[model samples]
Target: MAIMDLSSLNNLNLDAGSIFLLAITICAFLIPVVVILPPVGLQKGDALLQTHTKAGVEGARSNLKNQFSAEEHAPADGKPPRVHSLVVYPVKSCRGIELARSRVLPSGLQFDRLFMFAQLKSPFPVAVDSTDAEKSQHKWEFVTQRQFSRLANVTVDLWLPDEMKLRKQSMRSDEAFLILRFPWKEDGWRGLFATIAAKLGRGRAAEPEIEVLLPVDFPSAAEIKEKGYTFENVKIWKETINALNMENELPDELRRYLGVSNKLALFRVDPEQLREVYRCAPSEEEAGYQPVTGFQDAYPLHLMNLSSVQKFSSEVPKDDDLKELDVLRFRPNIILSGAPAYDEETWKQIRLKPGSSSLYNDVSFHVSCRTVRCKMPNVDQESGLRHPREPDKSLRAQRAVDEGAPLMGCLGMQLTPLFDPSLGEDRAAWIAVGMTIDVEERGNHVYIKQ
Candidate 1:
């Protein structure tokens, strides 16, 4: 294939290096490298530099169709999305911990909810762990799932003391200690010999399983709250907030299996004390930072939309005391995937990106509202039992259309963690579980979540 002899190409001296090598071999195989610039009055040693290279490829394709038509009038399809799952809860409407990766704190995950259940303050029988030093002047009222739906089968598991020499250690939840394991059922014959020795797997203790360890307190001195804490303000809804009780020691068989009387009292949320999401931002020192929380009733990350929770599991009401319904009854602490169910209410802010703990990449979060739907998703975190009227009666017949949030049923949102590097913040951005989201959308509206 070596010809080059068109009559000696007119004695071949077409200089300017053979017309810029024949205009880059006929426009570098045709266009698109920002149309090889050099237009608006062409210059590269012009001899009509190949006739202004088609006016620099139609001005780089009309400036790439006006910047993708301004990203099709932006609001994010900037494309990213994926983090499928990673729950936390660690006590406060209990039973949570599902992680293939986690530690994105600020307030969510990383020992979320911190530890709750207060109410033992007024009148009612109160006497299970009654250390009668005049019952430390009784007064502790938080208790949740609206009002104890067995507080969702309470379960918490955290370990620290040198396993793998502190695998990626992160501290300050008062330095580790939360074991708690419970569940007991007995009626007769010591629950019938602990249910016939459980088919011989050695099931004793009248078959209810126990395990406790507790001790993780740190509200920090001032005499431990001027003398062994009992502070407690706790309301969480109209946000009374501020808690401390829990001098650590709860076990009279977990106050008769959480019926709560024997001096249970464990509330905790006071370190660095900020709690002001001021109802969707603009308070924690005017949003410069600080949305602190512990017994999370409101904000510190939630985000759920596994296809709008499998389409709200066929919109509830499916017979036999309502079963098939667990996206952990809307508890969510990050669980997105692809999009469109309720299309994550239309995002507002998301970033994430980093799946295997290099400490986590990007990591953002702003979505501050729409979690509304209370009645604590009708309880049932594995039979803590509550389902009286499902999904708030099918979310008041099709998501109550938000009249500024009446009879709520919103489906996941609420996040705050703006920065973290272990809170001193210089951006560590951590977040796990498949991680990779981007989203933004500021207009498809969604706010109301008092």
Candidate 2:
């Protein structure tokens, strides 16, 4: 790079104002290459973000025809697949709660993705030059592990007052609570000792774990209307939802734990509002029902086979000292076992065999599409640390099976429950561990661009 001659500006014989304008012009061209361009190349965050494109859609649909000529059915082997694990994330991107049994609802497993963390909107006006989209981004936006990997360490549990004997003495039986537990805010030498002790599984260090109790059923919609309770419009993907702000209930310790200096708040999805699934949704004639979701990234439910995860782990590069990759990293609502690896790729519908808690019909889930992967799985659930690269590299190398999202790797299947209209919304069914999973239907999945 040649150094510009400072003497040339004086030789131009221009006024001070003109000289300043000329300098600004020079900087406009040079600054992008020197400062902005290099950082954007270094960031690589946009590559991890999924974008829908016309070419991707065309490629996926064109390849779908060649993928499967006819529908495939489940094998009739003596040992059928069974539900191995059930997990639900009450808060988006936070640690999930594993259950032996959970009530299946129209939206999803009860309490799944009902709450989320978001960056609060600024009180000031938007920038004058900002576009509508940029202005919208200034409002409350959803936060996730992709931006804050430490969220993985935040453990969440749903507690009903009726279930606990001690709570009954202090509160009404109908009252419920969402128990949030996270690392205690510590710094300096004490923070080091606490982190080390926590890693070593010492009992003493566990006492510093901060617990916050949030009323799951507080500040009803009626209360919001009457008292003008605090609320904000939170943007999740392309949708903006009206959410009840619960930041007042959380302590300042949480903000420190999240490493957020700006305004951050906890929000509960409004029960009165219903957000329906858009991408790859079946027609009412085909599904006989409309599927809905809360704060979930996409569909109502997500399922991953243990065999598929095991296969994926084996293929991932083991260059790091990190532990083996498991299904937990993908955060599936249901984990199925006893099936061959990648067998779900062809599955179109799955039925939970009617057992002792059977309703009039078997509970079925329609396979929406293959879940496209991002860098989120790189975040370790237990340690809350994100690996620089490994699984994501492996995913791009081998798991880019979906032609629709050819650049993206895929692991699990997105599912929407087949709601029986006659059953009514109030009637719910229970899905327990060890329930037999029957592949009721199978076909090639078509990826509909979001």
Candidate 3:
């Protein structure tokens, strides 16, 4: 080794250039050391101080807190909670259409869960393709996202034709159709290339979305004989009722996309044959009025608090894939904001009052029961793909609130509208997006249905 470093140093002046060079060398040497080292108080093998700690998850356990802590129940701003948005699911298990204003009827928000999918008791070719007389003998059961997650991707839109145009075309005044769209795969090598391109985010293009028009106004059971539809008894939950089978109306392409081209078919609820809500919180017998819904699982209206969803997301592990969960995962008919997290669990009765009192009277709803959640929320509403585990896993860990079903996680609330017999069939009350939700009563909820 040659000793040349000292000789160069003797000729060099301590100028700005030298100072800058020294600073750079010092920074280069220290940066790696500072970055690689652990925090001052932390040591190797010792658990790191997590930004979102397990304390959040532990604190989220409803069992750990009071039934409804008074301090935590009310909104921080002390303002009444207002409707954030309204959603109408024209078809059960399919996507919902958000609405700014919706009419509230004795049944439900108009046209909500008015249609549903059902599969023949036997597989498609055997029962579905059989002759009309033979087809009526086979049983059909309702299907939902709980069984097929891809149903989430089936987009539904209500399309009402212009009145004048309809009159010119010689169509019925009540004629309306539901426009449905879903993703589809093309045939042959083109499909392979398209899939590759989509994955690579390149020039890959997908086939045009498969669109189908579903008749919104179906003939009643009495009129089905003349309309080429079969009025059949279909099973939804445990109740078997008459539903108008619209299998002949739907296109084969849309059915194939659902992998039920032959086996599954569409059905519309028969208003005359609708079942009454059995598992009500106040009990329909005690409430003195029986309310009915077409295809709703339990109650007429399902509500969720946005704050509760946010609070649930906060309980998710920091390293989890989902940073925050979407509110649509729960499939709420009405979303409420301006309230604290998990506040709806304590609400027993509430009134939805619009900004303009003159437009419509305040509509009251008996907060029926806690919405005992299933793994349905695990499906992404946008992608139509199911997460192996996520919000559901976290839900089970933190939000098993309803003791009625300790194993099942609970979020949101089921509601039964206090329908006025005086309004009759023609007059319907309206609820808007900005309506305030007044908590008329608060009490502990008993999960009535599984």
Candidate 4:
């Protein structure tokens, strides 16, 4: 190591003022450098000062960077992966909207999974202190594409300014209102029209004419135990927590739309207060990862790999439509391209460097864990029909983690945005398409094979 020179200190007079000046100079030079270096054998007085004076700040800074920078791990892929596309499903299981760009919120993309459809009878008032799972107040079970493939046909669009103006009281913002598109009911005017047409000579009746459209708005209802905003205890999977469940014509509107007795509600993740992310790794828990999410299935973000999707498709018996499954079937917040097939499965963290777009600048995310997928992937996103086999079948043949829990056929991974240490959960840096990704950490490509 090249040593730094400290001859300038001796030029000062040997007076009281000179001595104090010498002391400050010594401290300023040694503080930054001493932390990284080892305890060395020090010669008496003058020799010790001379040795340390040669230990420069540059070496200390280099060591610090190496210890903390993204490149500390195996240097990221030479070509650096780029975001291929982005999708945000505002409502769970509903069709996802592809975006050229999107705001990266702590709970995932903005407006993603905020609203959901639930069984009508399944919703009932929950007692604040009830021990029975069903008795919990405002408890409702949500439905998804996993249960109904037609859910993919229920496309959602955001309302514009004029539309929001008409329903401002119910909708929080102009863009907040969702224009829900539903498939035509099997039994309705079209059914009668088709029945008559069959008698008139038009062969078999065409499927219900087309689709029905509805606008949904969430109006504030009575406040609950959570203090301020409308709070309800909603059960998802095995967990139930307090969330905002707005009341209005929406529940009835959705009921009529689906021809089912079900409740519909929007979840608002209050910035001041937040829902915690559970089951984090021990390291993340120690790092203070009590992150808040809105209506995401679990983690704030889901990342998919295009190569993995293609590789999986290659393994399945080819059909024209199935061949065209694309990335939408996976419903990921971010998609990465150019990485080797299934390579992302080994990543632990990624740093997203912005491309030409300024929207994605200096955003990094930590991989929470692998995404345990459901049968939702088996449903073709385009036709809103189940493929019966292939992706799910092939995945099961290769990637079942546990026969007891078949949902563990991992395809993608969940990501938690790593916020500035000072900001914590208060704010999240946004990311967008065309962003270049750098893998900052990697783990052994290990999986539980049942």
lDDT (C-alpha, whole model) for all candidates: 0.61, 0.74, 0.73, 0.61
Residue-level lDDT of model 2, residues 100-162, one tens digit each, is 667888788887898899886654676898787877665788889888899999987665433
Question: What TM-score does candidate 2 get on C-alpha atoms?
Answer: 0.74
Error of 3 at 217 (Å): 1.7
Clashing pairs in 3: 124-263
After superposing candidate 4 on the true structure, give the runs of residues whose Cα lies further than 4 Å from its correct spot: 1-77, 120-139, 160-175, 185-230, 246-248, 251-274, 281-289, 319-321, 401-407, 424-426, 445-450
Candidate 1 deviant stretches above 4 angstroms: 1-91, 94-112, 118-148, 152-220, 230-258, 269-304, 311-317, 323-330, 335-361, 364-384, 387-450
TM-score of 3: 0.72
Give one digit per residue, the lDDT tens place, for model 4 in 1-450: 865456655554477987799899998888677544423322122232321221112323322123212222222456777776677777788877666667776667776777665553432455666677656334466667777677787776643344433354343333234555554444687566645443333234433223222223333333333224355566666666665654442534445554455455545434444456755422455444556576677778889877777666667776865765556788888877667767887888889898756655688787767777667888888688787775777777666643434645778877887766677656656676668888899874343221
Highest-scoring model, TM-score = 2
TM-score quality measure for candidate 4:
0.64
True lDDT of residue 418, candidate 4: 75
Report the C-alpha displacement of residue 407, candidate 1, in angstroms: 38
Candidate number achieving the greatest lDDT relative to the actual structure? 2
Worst-scoring 10-residue span by lDDT in model 4: 48-57
Off by over 4 Å in 2: 1-77, 121-137, 163-172, 186-202, 205-207, 221-228, 354-361
